[model samples]
Target chain A: MLWAYLHCYQLTLDTYTPLQQGGSADEPTVVYHENSNSVVQMNAAAKQHGIELGFGLAQTAALCPQAHIIKYDKDVEKQALLSLAHQLYPLASDIVINTEHSLAIRLDNLLQYYGGYDVLWNTLTHEINQQGIHYHYATAWGIEAARVLAKSQINQMLRERTAITKCLAHCKLSYTDLDSKALNALEKVGITSIGQLLTMPVHELGRRFTNDTIRYLTALRGETFPTRTLFRPSSTFKQHTVLPFEVENSQHLLPYMGKLLDTLSHYLRARNLTTSSLCFEIQLREAEQQVMPVSAATPFTCATAWLDLVSLKVERLVLQQPAIALTLLCEDFEPIEKDTNDLFSDRFTHLAQKQLIGRLKAKLGEQSTQLPALGNSHIFEKMTVYQAQGNGQSYGFDAAPTFLLDHPKPLSVASRVCFGPLRLQTGWWEENTQKQDYFIAQTPQGVRLLVFKDTESKWWVQGVYS
Target chain B: MKDSLSLFNNHPNIWRAREQPANTSRFALGIHTLDEALHGGIPSAGVVSIACTTGIGEVSLFQQVISQQRKHKLRVFINPPAHVCAPWLTTQGIDISQVLIITPDNDADALWAAEQCLKSAACHCVLLWSKTMAAKTARRLQVAATHNDALCLLFSLASKKPSSLPVSLELSLKAHEANLTVDILKQRQGWPVHNLSVPFSWTPDNHAIQWAIKNNKRKVHSLHSVS
Candidate 1:
């Protein structure tokens, strides 16, 4: 089996001080944890200025006064790693992220599909570069050996155990999974590299070092398999982002909500899915949460379409309190089918129709728009039922008014029936049976109406044909 | 960017004028006289206001437009005066599913619903009923309809309103002697035409005709129908 390890060596610094536009890459940066009272990470420029990781914050400043210090955000780092895993998931057979800074992917199955290792390596590198992340990769016969090679920044693909062992001879002992005390003890005993450590007999090393060290060394050489949990995409999407400030009005909350939607779009795209509805919740200060649902008539994946609908919802919203946080949850997702448009079909028209329905549903309400389906029923009202609009086919049946009255209204005696005896009667099985003769009539004034006479001989005006 | 900006700036007429007068774009008001008077047809976009007396066939006009336009897109009725007869609409070959009826509580809700439907581009036409409207709301509705290239027609019951209302076409409709009289009070880029008679096909029942004639003759007396 062939495995490739993507080692994100800069994860700590990247998480702490995200490279912003126009920020100098050569600037000295350090990540200082105040609770631990030490510098956890520093860039190469900071190292050049005599500032090393694990230095106290005071010592860091003393060593390099111009170094920029930032606190590491673990949540952001975990999210970044997970997002990377999702992007790589579709390209690999199986992926296991064993540590915060690296992921191991099974690549033997993909070699044939990707036209061998070189093409896959180029594609992977291009994608990583496009996303503006720095990574080093190594491929070996086993997962642990590949991970060790990747930690040493060896960007080589080794298929044989002999070649992998030769490469491991140069890898530093500090890069392995051994404890600092054990490593330091070994260093004092003239063992500074993995090569020297492996030279010692297995039984001798097991007696001298802890059991974990022996096992780690065994795993490092691809001698024993290491345990790793396979990464899987979550079934439902729930992303929350704290607003920068307390937003008193819905309009002010749009920018924050927009950011959350962008993240949700990224999540959906990675999974190749689309959602018809999403629940948007706003957590307010000392007030009940405002949960608004934004839905489309059709399942949609476009970020802008969802953003537009949610923006309309926000516009019509009356915020009861100042919102301090926002959460977007979309639990239901359907596999998205990419439509291949025909040359004859007008693409804009179809998109425009969907946009229109989405806008109408957002502004007017979900019940505002519907599609008509012809049912097999004798009663006129029962013959046509308005179903909620989606991808359902619209049935074009016999001539009928586009409008239907909710209830029949009694007509005045002065109202005149112009056309009559379009008989319609049904509901025999049910208690509310109807025996009626319907008419397309005009009132004495001029207004055309649809009137009907029930079996009891009472006349009612069903609707004005407006 | 400079070339694109200047290209549009140099040819303002490209954005201002109607792109085409094809059947796909323009709505046939279903009356030949009205269509001719509209110079091709009711524009696919922009608001057309109908100032009417009671029973003047404004509902019939909207119904005709709805029936015709349903083939292309949905039709929206905002604040319809009465319930629409679904079965009747069905018999007219109008897709009942393509029709949306909205009953708004007040003028603001009605105006908002109208603007939304117009801007949605989901509906080929939006028919709105309003007794009165502030000029600003009418302007907003006009802009929305134009932006989405959808038709918006407002049926106003009060006929004696201002002549300078924001609308593409303003016509006063009056039903007289079994014929609908359409008076073009205002129209864009055309002279105001008055008292053009459009023939109405449906005739009232004989008994109702007798009742109406008697009521007219009495003038001060109420006439009840013989049931």
Candidate 2:
């Protein structure tokens, strides 16, 4: 029944910082929520300047004028927490994103893999520190108790329920999940520490306060609280970024586009899916938008392959106006089984071909390379049509020459007929009608050709049978 | 030079020039006399150019190559001057199912398709028809074919004069009376061969054609009466 809780105290602040841009970004930062009228989070630099969590926004501004304040976005914080949960998903199966700022994972299965609880705790804290994120974590026999201990800033590992009970006994009642009115009433009755409230009779507490207070006390001590919804990854990814300035050249927008691609890569890896099409929209300053789509010949999961294709497409674009922002949207994806290569297989050759074809299509147009496919017509011109690969159907028909002339030329010299009086005069319903008798013939010289005579008795060389 | 040889004898690990192995594995050209002239046949990689004043036996040569390579890999034809007739190809025992025809609008696309198909290894043979090509472009196609172990055959409607292209084999075909005479101008590490006469035949049986015409006439008459 051992469970672990991870609380990212500065989830809102980290979501707004450009940490992946790889430059020095250590500044006094705070996320101020206007609707809640409080400072939701602050980095250490802001804390050093006397800015604290839960302070009024105006009070924080007054206390620390040097703080870099950003408006808080709850959706960003939730997405960041979801991403963090996805990263920790391989470590455990039953992961619950408890709130916008915290996650809870059952750790019984993870302890066996990490060898011990001490090593797991050290590894988790070390990774969080390396990611430049502020977090507090604790493990207990109950998930709710672990969450309460984490919120109360008591970072320790409790093996037994009694140890958790003992730890909660010393803590004050302010850290419980009970409502504020219940806490105020409890404080008025001289019950300060959790031990005092636990020592009191349950009926007496129930008589004084509502049943919710007694229930809260019970849940804090690992009695109830079992209902939880496990976190599942979303199906689609939509991310956008506004450039710092008006970008006239698409090459300059690559770095900003890179950030969105990183987020998309993480999303794809978490769900084990690959995308075939990606649509990018650039919002230009001329009151119009440019929609560019990059598609792959085959479904792919590698992020660099997709990025290289997108870079080539961007390089070939001729922007009509300066762009102010860009958005990347990908909704259609196919689930793919992970590839397992054998020892004697030429796996790289196939991969190299796909990549080469993809790059060539990106550089040249899609129609530059075509494969022959059977068309649904009996006429010579329409019998076999050249189409892009995977875009046509195969139809069985009569025998025809491997090459036909682009234009049928009038032949003056006579030739001996070898095979065909195959008459083909069927398209009368269309504007351009043809009525001709075709023959496969060879001249006195060694050239073999396909000759046809129209209704006007004019002989023409349709194609050479070479 | 003697000291160097002694040094090589003392230390076998020292690097020296090794003898070039003879290329034995080749794709038979399907013509017995031409195969003998070619020592065995064409190497499975590199370029073979057919230079001619007029396109006399070019189509027949293409048909032979296509049918031969059809069983092993995809046969790609890039930008022939006319539309390829599939029925004739299928009649020559070429598998039309494995044949892909690319119709590029210009020479650049033809060259590009040739290079890409050679490098992809998806196609074992690529046949390109172009009026003219730069020496650099021809060399690029040669290298790509050699690197990927695919065959490249270029049928040119130009002269057979000496050029800077590193073509492994070059043959000039002249349309003589009732037969095709092919002159081997260049062969890698082999003596030049004189004109060799070859026979060409591509006509269906008389009874087969008669039977086909009878069915076709019946279909036409039935459609006319119904209309």
Candidate 3:
């Protein structure tokens, strides 16, 4: 149809401000039913006066005053909207966002589940209004016609399937079937409404209109609606949110992120899943969004695990402004595998050991803990050493004297016995100044070890029998 | 020096639990004797501290532990300073294929890696070449060893002995002939520690040095001392 029905609202008055005063965020107040980038939605008094949606600021304040105007934040709005989409994903086959405040969804499949069209509409409207939003809806065969009707009509009927096609056929099908350029001549002929435009011949419409217009007209008549295959879900986890308006502060997104975390954690736990890797994406107003990724060495889950891994990656953010939208996604994850360990068996001891080791490592640090090994050397001065990895050896046993003289019991011998059993002298040049007389003895207990007399003539045992 | 390394080195040797004369899996170091008398043997995991002021037979003792564990198929990871003569441990019955040497430039790294291995519960035993360690870390290792059922040993230069230790055996050192005089100072499992000592020494066969033959198998000789 050649009808040019404009949504008559003083949206600009309440939407924007002097470009100098506000810059990119500055705009007029009258909040359109949808964020009409064509008009501002941030004018001060107009917004306060309940003059929001589809108006100019200059015109808004004149009609109504005392409005709390807001600046345009497309990024935030897109994010908030996308998040809403994820939540409602189970309801519809195709949900297309028209603008920040508007959505185009096919309700045929979900109609029965929702108890019919009116019930669904009422529920959706209630949900939207609960978010402090004043909303409106429009339906037409063509996407552009739907947008225009939604703007022009303050309150539109919700149509279902074939009925939707019938209701939208007039305005949508006419322009779609004959195209406007073909109707430009009709325009000169004083033809406008679809009723009037239909009188024109089809060949005339095709001859004058573009192919797109003709195709859309057929589409509106239930011949086609761009049938897309049932969406095949991919193996990924994603979360997002939509905003009533745009926002730029990063902190402002925390509450939204909290909601995402709740949803994500529930999803994972339901499937007994754990993820050690995740990705984050933030959408901007007009520029490309940013993507950040996080990884852990092992599978992790719930709030604590995810938070720990994320904290490391988020420490490097350098944003000068706030993010408008956010998305949390987990592309890969592992299933939570089960393990069996007896409650009181030694197998559980490893966990205990882990606890002890962790506590010590935390307190004393890693450097302080070590395992002793044997020093590989011959000279007494060179040999008496322990390495951390002593090669799984027991001490003094391998080198114990095979001859068991006796067990541990004091030898009441002369304190300074000049027993020339064996004068062992070595390491003189290597600073090992030693002059010792050694002996192998058997105590009353049948213990055998190497004993020696120092230069001072005092006797003592050095090592024990295995 | 890169000599200090754990079993993690992609060498042919690998991590295996102790399995042998099953009873020997538990080494009952005369707690009454060695525990109070000296630093404990190598830790099942974590750092084990030991030192010799005089003829302590440090290498000989390390060899015994290594040989025993090796007999049960446990691998020995060695990290020694540049001064350690590798042949000494071999001479004490430690299997050549079982011994993995990690020469280390930083003594601290060697110590840390050794503890980590023990902490992992992957290796039968771990050893660090060190002269000293913090008391807290030593105790933690004792607890870990008990939990994981593995042993850890640390070698340290003898200074002042630790006041309270978790060691099962403590020995006072003296040398006579080719034996190490082990004076029993403390025992954990009721090992008697009086003025008496265990006669132990290492002897070489081919390139392997081992703890002397069974004390009972040796010649029946006794030292009658003055009253």
Candidate 4:
């Protein structure tokens, strides 16, 4: 089987640049390993300033005083690599995230469908170029060989055994997966290039190098296959982003939140699903993490629509402390239901109605808006219920008051009975028992009220007919 | 002078009253004299302001109008005076599922919610209860309602001073026993009418009265026997 390997040489730089705030495109930037304290990757601007790889922090600062220094994060680099793999999943069927900054894709199965190698390579390159990531790729008969070649910056696609052997000969031994000890031993034995190492027999090198190095040389030569777990898209979407600077204001988190939502939108679209709610966990500097849940009335996949709802909620948000990081988690996913409509009818009304509810709930608290529903109760006050979402059950009742008061007021004005003496003596199980004689009373001012006389013989007005 | 007049006429923002397109579609108020006074009925799409006191049969008067507009569309009630009884809404033949009630903390949010519901085009009718409304706010609500072909009914407490807000129809309601006295304060493309009596559909139910009479007879017999 043929395999193709991709190496994201500037994974740290690419992931860091998008999240970096207030930096010009022409500005020089470099990311250095925290432990090693040496530059791992640099942009072209920094490269032009003679700042090379493995340069210490002091050396980098001395070379370009204006250079932006960023510490490398392995976890962020891995997430970026996985996100890149997810983007390319549609193009390549079988993919393995080989390293924190590289991926291996089996292309034998795709070659037949794509007709040829050139077409598949073009399709892969087009998708990668759109992401604006700097990558080097090499295709070979084995995964290890392809990874080694791509890591060494030898960008070529070789199908023939002779061509691959000739290409591997020119690559230095340092580019191989062998350890430094094995390389030093091989160098002491006057072996510099992979071409010289290939000339030696396995048993002849076995006495000098370790067994692991022997296995690596065999796998790099396409004699053995290494097992790897292929990458599959996760069912749930979760993304954690560290802010380059502390955002004291909740509204300023919009740009960072917006980027995460865009990525979420892509993830949802790729899976043909929609979500109605998203949980945002804000990592404050000195306070407990704040969780802000933004929900929509209807499930949708548009990032801008979700952002609109989020911004409405964010405008009223009071941050307890300055936020340093943000995590977006969405666990529930629903399949999109196609709305069937008449050819001439307007289809946007349904969506607009749901969006209106979302906007109202976002601005004025969730409980501010409610849908009127009927409840199963004989008591006048317990008959109506308000729901936050969904269509209420259609239940009909006879001749009720127009509006019910939460608390009954004492009958103060002189009133005449219009229609009355309907005794409602139910509610035996509940503590608040109903044993009153209800009446339809009209005051002298021509106002109709739903009045009742209780067990104490005191008159109380419950509601109005208007 | 002709050139200046032509310039004013050709301006995009300037339009004479005669040049404005008349909206003719209306929903019958189900009140004969009231419908006749407003020509066809209430204009189906613009803002209609009602000045009335609470508990004066004003809500029951528009019950039929609101119910008729909820045909697969939402009807929003912003800041109703009290809890709108679901059973009462059902009695008016309104689909409870299509009714949305928004109780905002203040009038500003209530007005904003009203404008949003009107402009959404998903709501066929919006009813807002406010004590006072500025002319600018009324005009904004009118524009929003007109854009989406939605009706907005603004209900304010009755005041002695007449409002000069731009609305399609303005009526002042007064309670008069079983009928409500509706005076058309202002109407679009029609002359104002005074003291149009519109009867309420909620008459005293004879069944309830009969039931009450039978119970009263039973109570009297028991009291007489005990004495």
- Top candidate on lDDT is 4
Which predicted model would earn the best TM-score?
Answer: 4
Worst lDDT window (10 residues) for model 3 chain A?
A: A1-10
* Tens digit per residue, CA lDDT, model 3, B1-227: 35555534545433233322112124434333443343343233333444444223554555555576524333434354322333344445555333434444465655555555555554456555565556666676666666655666655555554444555344444554434555444434333344444554344222121233333366645697556
lDDT for each residue of candidate 4 in A343-424, tens digit (9 for 90 to 100): 4344567777889899999999988899888876678887887752255444456758888888999999999888767899
Per-candidate TM-score, chain A: 0.66, 0.74, 0.47, 0.85
- lDDT (Cα, tens digit) per residue for candidate 1, span A37-130: 8887778899999987679988988888888776665664566677667667667648897777678888778888988777887777776665
* Listed models, DockQ each: 0.22, 0.31, 0.03, 0.59
Give model 1's DockQ, 2 decimals. 0.22
**Candidate 2 local distance difference test against the native:** 0.73
Over A373-397, each residue of candidate 3 has an lDDT whose tens digit, in order, gives: 4444433433424344446443332
Q: Quick one: ranking by lDDT, best first?
A: 4, 2, 1, 3
Interface RMSD of each: 4.7, 3.6, 11.6, 1.6
Residues B49-105, candidate 1, lDDT per residue (tens digit)? 887754445656655666776465767777776544455456655676667777666
TM-score rank order? 4, 2, 1, 3
Q: Is candidate 1 or candidate 4 better by TM-score?
A: 4
What TM-score between 0 and 1 does chain B of candidate 3 receive? Answer: 0.56
TM-score of 1: 0.69
Instruction: Estimate TM-scores for all models.
Output: 0.69, 0.74, 0.39, 0.86
